[model samples]
Target: MNFIPQFTQRSAGTEAVVSLPHGGRRPGRELLVRALIGLAILLVITLLVWFDRDAYSDSGGDGLTFVDALYYATVTASTTGYGDITPVTPGARLINALVITPMRIAFLVLLVGTTLEVLSNEVRRVLIDRRWRKRMRNHVVIVGYGVKGRSAVNTLHQQGHDLNRMVVIDNRPASVDEANLTGVAAIHGDATRREVLRRAEISKAREVIVTLDRDDSAILVTLTVRQLNPSAHIVVGGREGENVSLLRQSGADAVVTSSDAVGRLLGLSAVSPNIGAAIEDILSSGVGLEVAERQVTANEVGNSPADIRGERVVAVVRNKTMRRFYDQSVDTLQTGDNVVVIRKSEARAEKERSERD
Candidate 1:
């Protein structure tokens, strides 16, 4: 049985705030349905009284008519009780007190409750956002919720990173909502906007990932983030290879060119399926095979790459510089060196086993 390595990080307890767009309001289906049902009930009760015209008296000296019934129903259901229409018989009065009153209350609730709930929820959301902002620090800011951005987030989660310490900012409301549904903080706004970036606490962010669909937008967002936090790690995804250098120049510490990467993957798959599969496995976290960086073990110290047992050492990172296994300088592992290894991910093994059973 393989064991998955897990890391524990402290929670910052900061939540994401959402900025809703202002537009024309449309009634929700629930509200519309309830309103129709309430109206139907009121009409039914009014019609019942109107059919038994002798049961009602009118101060206006008009014998009960369909118009009178409709007017009475409207006034009664609204609790206005214009006093122009009165139930004269005991049957009518009993029905009014027992049936009409409750229905009237229901009608009012159906008509007005949705608005009150919306307002209450808005106030509560604002309060929660204020609290969230106060506690946010050293979080990861994702500038877009596009495909690349989402994949990056998924990998971070599988690597045991604290998602609560991450915030997603996107101009698309749908994307923001999707992030929120996954329990990550999301802000619906253009990431290139300084105010939006500031609201996301870029100054205190430890890292920022820019994955805007447009290379220009990603570059602008990266520049804004870099200006906000000179020390933060800024990684950007550019759609075109030519923009990769532009993105890096715009202050991105790393730039992944989408088209070039896809092309490379395709080429590798066509040339050697096994090698391509191995690369894919390593790129995908918590999968069949994975690449991970770990501190040099006590047993590994003073040992060559070929001497390490159980895992394959692809490279060694010493003093923030990476050297491949083929490099003679990295032949002997030293203390403080990080080993980049390729091995079967225990999480994937367990998941496969579970699926099999």
Candidate 2:
């Protein structure tokens, strides 16, 4: 969709023509067909006039035959009234008033309709294109459309979600178009601006991921987003390790050093290949399960891992080693021990219902 605005101005005596760019294929073809048909009809009328010149002349100075009537209709419809061939008789005058006048009116209506249709199509195309750009949900919004930002977008796109809502905000048109083409909503404006955030609908957004090249710009974006919507989880990718803490202090929930994440992944791959594969699968594949950390605080049954009724505990990530926690284990629960539970949708719903009751 073209982001350029269509502007039109009308003066005191001059008519304004708003030339709409060719929108879609169908409407453009329809307009062309209509104009061609109208031209064909006018040509046919002219041919009939040329064939019966004697019949037209029989009425003398008063009567206008087929040729004269045709000529008058053409000139009037074209808005080029030469006044050379005047209708003389009352019959001819009445014919001119009815046929010629109505023909001119019809031509004007067709012209206006075609023009408006094209313009409407252009506007609709832009809206639809914009909608496509913003179709992702629960997505990470990157502030800058730079290399790191682009890589993040590609990774997110590869790691498909139920709702792929990703948006990129940069003050450059080319960057915006690049983002848009990648099926990400790219708004051309300052990410630090409050209005730009408003356009991005930052409040309801799940996560705001800032990967601006400069530390100052990323900091500003993080601050603005935090101020606008405090609850939104903000993640920033920065170069300097020192600035990471500063960005976090400025309200970034998590600061990701691109180098650090890469290094960590590389180190983990060397130490534990299987663990690295699992991590990569979780990050890259939608089907990969996520072992969420849920603290079992309430001992409705008893202060024991085995006594925690309802849901199944898959594993216990204690001392960085995953220990399989069985259902029949009589072991008591520790206060700070992390429980890795396999999330079952039915179990979750039951828990919710029981809590509500």
Candidate 3:
């Protein structure tokens, strides 16, 4: 067997030798300074012990040693009085009072400084992460930080989308801070401006979501984003019964009206509450079931919904009837049938991953 030196073996066993040099080097330096200060305090106690030993012994009947003085200083700094060691002479008491007061003040200062440094480091880490996330490209930029925008961001994040790749552009500083706290890259800027859109990496973004409450702002943002990046997939939110044809004409790929969707949901609930509950469960991200529309190519499945890449097909909206496509043996998937696939969000994510790759 090869001979390994004891120092080398101990170094490998503890791993401390490798880490000791770099372990909180700054804190170590501070600790070293404190240790030197403590040593100087002990040296002062030694000098005082030599000078005041006779005076202390005259009152206590036992000579005051260097260790006794050092112990007294430590106890006074920590605010833990043992009552066993008492200074009797006026000179000794005066010395104790002078040294103990400064030691207590120094201890308090050190404690506050250390606490503030720890908090400062944590804040710096969060700020750095926020800055790094803002600089990333190919992100899905959400133009608003309202309820709709927040809901969309939460859904995407819960679906395991990278928060760094999902940038939030809001006008309010509070909204930006909220998004940043959630690890979502957020910048405070007007979405209607081309410069603001550029700052959000509009040209490089894969998707742009406009969820502003103001219809005019939404329309203007849509137009601007389309003009800036014609190829980006733009999704806009509109009010109830609001004509989004102009928005679509302006180049939004999809327009979602919350008023219309909510009205429809309420109507469905009035008719069949269980069905509405099921629909809500499917739509809710927490339920893990997503009602996703998958486009079938002519060459891929030969127009067959049964051949789609999922476990179950809930319904096929063909001829606008919402017929059951679960057990249907249709040979061809018609061009217009929006295949409603009810499956786990993970499955949809996997499908998206495959398509992207």
With candidate 3 superimposed using the best TM-score fit, by how many Å does residue 145's alpha carbon deviate from the native? 1.0
All candidates in order of TM-score, best leading: 1, 3, 2
The backbone clash count of each candidate, in order, is 0, 3, 3
Tens-digit lDDT track for model 3 on 99-214?
75676677757767767876775565455444543566677989898899999999877766777578788877667656655666665667887766776668888889999998
What does the lDDT read for residue 339 in candidate 3?
69
Residues 78-114, candidate 1, lDDT per residue (tens digit)? Answer: 8888898899899988988898888888888877887
Global Cα lDDT for candidate 1: 0.79
The runs of at least 3 residues in candidate 1 whose Cα sits more than 4 Å from the true structure, single-residue gaps closed, are 1-16, 19-41, 107-116, 349-357
Worst 10 residues of 3 by lDDT: 15-24
Best by lDDT: 1
lDDT value, residue 192 of candidate 1: 76
Please report, in order, the local distance difference test score of every candidate based on alpha carbons.
0.79, 0.64, 0.69
Instruction: Give one digit per residue, the lDDT tens place, for model 2 in 204-226.
Output: 67888898878888898899999
Q: In model 2, which regions exceed 4 Å deviation?
A: 1-78, 82-111, 114-168, 172-186, 203-206, 270-275, 287-357
- Between prediction 1 and prediction 2, which has the larger lDDT? 1
